[model samples]
Structure formats: structure tokens, C-alpha cells
Target: MKLIIKSLIMILFAAGAYAADEPDMKAGEDIAMKGTPEGATACFACHGTRTEENKTGSFPRMVNQSQYYILQQLKDYSSGARNNAVMGPIAKALTDKEKADVAAYYAKILFPTPKVKKAASAVLKRGEELAVVGDLKIQVQACNNCHGPGGMGMAPAIPAIAGQHANYLEAQLKAWKDGQRKNSADLMGPIAKRLSDKDISALALYFEQVQINAGKAVAK
Candidate 1:
């Protein structure tokens, strides 16, 4: 009898897991179609359904982004760990299931073609050098170790930092360095704590100027 009960429980758990994995594209489409004022933008307007215009230097293409990473980011934004006025309200309004559905929809989409041709400036170049190779005296690890050589980041965990707004990057780093941002991993927390104001600014500027080669890179 105990064995039969255990089997039933296992079956139920499997079913639940299967349900969780199912992608609800229709729901995602509906959300995209119905742009929320509080959310303040339709994802399709920026990301597009299927096109190369989505691949710009200013906007990190959301197409093909990892679902787990997207979900985590949404949660972070909603909770204020990752703060963006534009994204914060939008994230706050989404249910967990909505977040998951949106993430899935974007993750399944193919990457758009990139068109950005400009390179980083001298100051930005300096910032990039610092990010890729930190000063040992400062006890800073190269951002590349986790964010990848080009700032693409690891899937389902770390997020892509490439092409993010310099202001936004600066703010986030400052938050991390201080105790204001609390939702980061233990490793990141310590790293953030160690960063000086100057270090944070340099890293943010560096990532902002970096262009991601979508075909070769994965954003966090």
C-alpha cells in the first residue's frame, strides 16, 4: 500500500513538472498585444515578433534570452533589487506565471541580425580594459570570468551586461556596493561590497559601450 502511494505521489509530481515546463505562447502574445500603461510598453514594439530591427546596440535583443534568466530578472526588478523605473512598474504588475510565459516566448524566438557598427570611445575603452582585467591591488576579479569575455553572461543565472544604459549600470553597481541591493547571490554580494565608487563607474561605462555578437554570445 505504501509503495502504491509513493508511486502515485511520484506521478503527481511528474505531472506538475510537465505542466510547469509547457510554454504558453498564446498568453505571451496577448500580453504583448495589450500594452499596459503601468508596464509602459509593449515588448513587441522593442523586441519585435520576428525581425532584425530588434538587434540594435542600444537595446539588448530579448529574443532567444533564457527563460530562467528572464524570470529571475523580472522578479529582481519587481522586488527592486534590479531597479529600472521603466521596467519596475511593468515587472510589478506581472504575475509569476505571466513572467514565466513571457520569458518562454522570448527564449524560443530566434535572434535578429545586428547592425551596430560603432566602437567604444577612449574612455569606454579604458573602462573595458578594467572590466576584463581588474587591478589585483584592488582585489577585483575580471568581470569576464562570470559575464564572459564580451559581457554575454552565463545562461539561467548571470545576466548580460552588454549594451545596458550607462546610468542604469552605474546605479545598479552603486546599489550592489552599498547594502541597498539585497537579492544578489552571496558571491556577487561580496564582490559588490569590495567595489569602490570609481570601480563601479568604470565597469558600468565599459559594459555600456560593449556590443554583443548575438550569434556567438548568450546574455544572462
Candidate 2:
């Protein structure tokens, strides 16, 4: 009889814990739309609404991301684990609750469709050769093995690289190659280590020009 009572109590406690962790989606939207308590700009201003133009690529699209992933990134920015000068200040200013709220809000937004101009014949030919066949002399794997044929990422872990800003992609690839960024997966470390500077530059340029359909579920 005592064991049965204890089991019931434990179950109730677990239920309460789950409820506490679940984000309130509506409240998150409100906070995201209204701005952080310190009067920072609303996220939509940079990410764009359903019809707005997000031309500068100053902000990466945040829509349709996993809430857990978004929360982790915000915390990383806030704690100085991820170091982007512009984002660090903004992230540091947010309260914990506000961080969760904004994460949920962005995760619920629709992902933006990408539009890319066709590459020049020479560039496209080079990119296709490298992405599909790899250069045997360099010992590089075909990019499509991990990044997918269209550059859609494998999901919650790998980010979609298609249509990311060319400059941003180049910078990140350099960081990874030089060991300046250490947060990547074990597989990524070795793969990045094998890439030459020129190879990295070409791959980044190629991916920046690739496009993917928005609103489709990414691999997770």
C-alpha cells in the first residue's frame, strides 16, 4: 500500500516537471513581437514578416527551428560561449524567461523561401565536380554525403547551409578550418581539417548560391 502511494506521488512530480519546462507559445509570440524589456528591436524587424524583404542578410532566418536548438543558441550567446560581437550584447541583455519566450516565438515562425541566381557556367561546373565527386588527391568527401544534395541540413544538429550569406559561410568555414570554432561535431572536425583554404572558399561560394524550398521539414 505504501509503495503504491509513493509511485503515485512520483508520477505527479514528473508531470509537474514536464509542465514547467513546456514553453507557452502565445506568450513567446507576444514577447517576440513587443521587443525585449529594455526596448530592443522586435525580432521581426530583421527576420521579416510573411511579406517583408530581408535583403541584407544581417539576420539569419530563425523560423521553423527547433525550440531546444534556439534556446541553446541564445544561452550560448548570453554566456559568451558563442562570440559574435553584435549578437553578444543583445543576447546578454535578455532575461532568462525572455530568452525562452523569444526562442519559442522564432521557432514557430515560417521559414523563408530562398531565391538564388544561377551560377556562371565555370563556377557551376567547378562546384558540381567538387560537391559530387571530390578531388581524390585532396582526400575530401563529396559534400552531398552530409549536407544533402540540395544543401538542406540533416536537421536539429547541422544547420541548412544553402542560401546562407556568402561572407558568413566563408568566415565560418575559415573558423572551423583554423580551429577558432570548436563547437562542431567530431565528424566535422576531421572533415574540416582535410579541406584546403582554396577548397573551403569554393565550397562556401557554391553553397551560398544554392537554394532550398522553405517550409519542408529538415532532417533531425
Candidate 3:
């Protein structure tokens, strides 16, 4: 009986170690499509597939986002730093390796650029100013300083927000401003606090309509 118990423990440890190895994109793809037997919901239910857009506009586009960014977000959600009723449960359901694998899988997929209706010119202009040239009066820096030109994203961490869903962007900004989301408090928190509701709306709309070459190298 002692020998059997020891052997079982060894097998479990080995399995855990294997799972922590390099990310497996194939496993991630399967999890994204089918969810896990451990009670997590399928990612496709909210995020949609590469060919299909999530018309709800509540969920942000996931394709080609930085793997590191995605992984960190998942970690934040699991830890309750980024409070989301939906994402929290899902992130907790996934193992550390599963999160890494899923992030890697999404980062590799080539998604089509989204097309959204443009907001009023004035709104877009205000948003463009904020994104390209930070307001001196408010002492805010241009969003592009970190997000990269056209929101193409800075390599391993920052995510590409260009052509993302406006509704999702707006909601996230509001969440940060309201102190509901604290995962990126040092950077986004202050910036978002300075943005009025109108500013948030305009910025969201502006980014939704801006398109860029997905394959282009983002500024480091």
C-alpha cells in the first residue's frame, strides 16, 4: 500500500511538471474552442473565432495580441487584480500552463482588420489629438508613446488596440477610472482618471476605426 501511494504521487508530480513545460498551441486551440472538462467556458463563446467577429462589442478582439499581455491579463483576472465577473471564473479555472498556451495560440492567429463606422469628425479629432499629441493643458502624454503608432502595440507585452471594439475599450477605460480595475494602476489608472466620459468615448471610437498593417513591425 505504501509503495502504491508513493508511485501515484510520483505520477501526479510528473504530470504537473509536464504541463508546466513549453506552451502547447494545439492544446490552447482545443481549450479555446471546447473549454475544459474542469468547468471553464469555451473562449469562442465570448471572443469568437478569427473569421467571426463578436458583434456584442463587449468583448475585445483577441487575435494577434501580445502573448505576454494576454498571459498577464489572465493572471490578473485570476488574482482579482482585474475584476471581471466573467473572466475571473474562467481564469481561475485554467492552470498556469493553460493560460500560457492560450495566450500563445491567440497571438499566432492572423485576424482580419475590423471595420467600424466612424464617429463624428469632431469626436475623432479630439481622440486623434489625445492619441497622437497629448494635451499640454492636462499634462497627459500621447497614447502612442506606449501603445505605438496607430495602436499597433509594443512587442512582448503591450497589446494592439487599433481596430478593437469601441464598446469594450470604453468600458475598460471607465473601469480603470472608477477603480474597479487595478491591474495596470501605475500607468492606465492615472491616465484614465484624467479622461472625461466624452474623452473615453471619443478615444474608443477613434481606435475602433483606425486600421494598420497587422504584419508591420511595431516600434520598440
Ranking by TM-score: 3, 2, 1
The best-first sequence of candidates by lDDT reads: 3, 1, 2
State the TM-score for model 3.
0.86
Model 3 per-residue lDDT tens digits across residues 1-220: 2443354355345434532467899999999999999978999899988788778899988855877778878988999988889999999999998999998888888766666776899999998899899788876778887788878787555678887888999998998899887776656777888899999999898888877564653211
TM-score of each: 0.66, 0.70, 0.86
Give the clashing pairs for model 3: none
Indicate whether candidate 1 or candidate 2 has the larger lDDT: 1
lDDT of candidate model 1 versus the reference: 0.64
**Model 1 over residues 1-220: C-alpha lDDT tens digits?**
2443354355345434543567687777676657554563577766566654444334445633567777778788888877666778888888877877877777776654444333346656656666778667767677777666677665555567765555567776676777677665344656767777766776776676565564454222
> RMSD to the native, candidate 1?
9.2
Q: For each candidate, C-alpha RMSD in Å?
A: 9.2, 9.8, 11.1
User: Which residue pairs clash within candidate 1?
Assistant: 159-220, 160-220
C-alpha local distance difference test of each model: 0.64, 0.62, 0.80
